[model samples]
Target: MKAFVFPGQGSQFVGMGKDLYETSPLAKELFDKADAILGFKITEIMFAGTDEQLKETKVTQPAVFLHSVISALCMGEAFEPSMVAGHSLGEFSALVASGALSFEDGLRLVAARANAMQKACEANPGTMAAIIGLSDEHVEEICKEVSVGGKVVIPANYNCPGQLVISGDVEAVDAACEKLKEAGAKRALPLKVGGAFHSPLMQPAQEELQEAIEKTGFNTPKCPVYQNVDAKPHTDPTEIKQNLIAQLTSSVRWTASVQHMIADGADDFTECGPGKALQGMIGRIDRNVALHGIA
Candidate 1:
């Protein structure tokens, strides 16, 4: 069996969709439709604008979605997945690729989600950090101890065996990083992210997104999707909705998701997104795992 995975943020770059836009008529029509739907020529920013322009949360989320989904669309009948999963924002793309959401609806929902998250970030200032070479339990305990007085610091991304990302308020994250390093973490480094995603800080964003998610239509998927919140394959639409809601505030169990896929007979894991980040993480989680990229 083959599993198709999609990357989240931090995979996008300038000139991301230039090749598709210039070569494939299907890609061109979709890009043009996206520009009309978004009410702006995002293609301009994606193809020619500066990194600063592409980095806006509102733009980055939808832009990455477009790149991944359009690439998958252009794959014609060659793209098939026994199981599907995505990291963070990539879940929306995965849902579309798996036939759970229509392309138009997916793009609209991604735009709404991005705007909501950005607004939440502006309302509450926070950040995230990467802690390398620390056990998951050790990192969780340290974060819990450091997040005293209603401040925030929690494990956000379980990327691979010894690599975890923490998210919370600026001060809490900094303190946790210091303590993690003191506790023998190889490196406790702050990420260049704008806010603390997948933490309590995103509660406001979750509340805002709830309405849109409920309003959007969901259908039976073409294949089971291993959702981020639970790291399990789900076929029911209700379960998918609940998981997506929880995903905004829960840690991404990517390591566990990959393990589940492998256990279920997945042989080829193809990453359908911009970067090879997922491939690298999957490789580290299980050296026997094979990976392919669709970039």
Candidate 2:
């Protein structure tokens, strides 16, 4: 029972895939193909660009995806998964690794998703915040209360116990942070993200990406993928496509997904991505489960 997990967004760094590029010719070929597909030298930015440059939404998403998918590919026969799951943008990586989507199509969709999300952010200025030391119920209730009179705020990521991220309008999120802190939260910290992803504010991005997703072809996956939107295992291409499209404006149920995986016999989790963030979260979710990281 091994589950291969992929990380998203914040997992990226300046020199993320340089070691893979330098060590494996297969990795180099994929990196070169990525540059051509993206119409730019993304590998250069990933290996030597400034942190500020890597932080750009368009660069961050695809860079992380490339690292994750390429790492899994380089594993060759060793990269077997009973189940797969990803956090946010990493879902695209999971699909590619599991054979649900081709490498080229996954990269294209990820680039499209990033550009669409960036456009949505510019069109509607919003933000996200981390709420620590609060129960999920309390956070959800407070978010609902704060989301009134056109203010749209909601829980976005259920990372682990006592840790959740909320996203929405800037003012609403700030206000929610204050209220959450006042309600005995250990820390209510704002995240340095481009916009309120996984919230109603991303509806425009969802609409824009839906077309790209529907147009892309999907195949039956080699293994089940635990989708972000529903925290459920999906093998059907049609269902996976629908869930991926909904993920743009839906919460990432990481906690539930991990729990479900564990209950369904996922005794080990290998994080194949730029950072060990998913490993840490999976550790928090269940200490008994074995955890490993490829990057």
Candidate 3:
């Protein structure tokens, strides 16, 4: 069976979907629709914006979603999958691709999510860091030791073997990074993010997004979507909605999700997004599985 995966943030670039926009009429039509729905020329920013401009949470989220979903649409009859999964914000794109959500609805959700997250960030300053060459347990222990007196920190993204991202208050994250390095991590590099995602700091964002999510309509998906919150495949609309609502404060179990997919008979994995980060992570998770990329 084949599994289609979508990448989240940090997968975007300046000229992400320009080629597709210029080449395919279908892609252009979708891009135009996105611009109208977003109330601005997002296509202009996506095609010619600077790195800093595209890095804004609002632009980054929907820009990546558009590139991924439109790329899948451009695949036409070839874009078939036994199952689908996405990392963080990419979940919206996966839902649309799997027929669980309409394209316009997905874009609107992404935009709302991004704006809410940004607001949460501005309200409470925080950050994230990447820990390489450390066991997940070891990193978790370090985070626990460093987090105290409301300085909340926790493991955020389990990217692959020996690679995990931690998120929390800026001081707590920095202290955790130091301890993780002392615990024999190869590198504890801080990420360029505005706030601590997938941690308690995002509770405000979660609360804000919950209303939008509940208001949006979700149809039965064509295939099961392995959600980010629990790394479990969910087909029911209610279950999907619940998982999505909880995902803002839950660790993204990418490694476990890929393992579950492989165990469930996903032999061929195709990454549908701007960057090849998911492909690389899946490769490291299981070398025996075949890998392909759409963008």
Alpha carbon lDDT of residue 132, candidate 2? 92
TM-score of each: 0.99, 0.99, 0.99
lDDT value for model 1: 0.93
Looking at candidate 2, what is the lDDT of residue 218? 100
> Per-residue lDDT of 248-277 in model 2, one digit per residue for the tens?
899999999999999999999999988789
- lDDT tens digits, residue span 1-295, model 1: 9999999999999999899999999999999999999999999999999999999998999999999999888999999899999999889999999999999999999999899899989998899999999899999999999999989899999999999999999999999999999999999999999899999999999999988999988989999999999899998999998888888889999999999999998978989978999999999988886789886
For model 2, the local distance difference test gives 0.96
> Candidate 3 has which clashing residue pairs, if any?
none
TM-score of 2: 0.99
Steric clash pairs (candidate 2): none
After TM-score superposition, the amount by which residue 195's alpha carbon in candidate 2 deviates from its true location, in angstroms, is: 0.5
Better of 1 and 3 by lDDT: 3
Weakest ten-residue segment in model 2 by summed lDDT: 273-282
Superposed Cα deviation of residue 121, candidate 1 (Å): 0.5
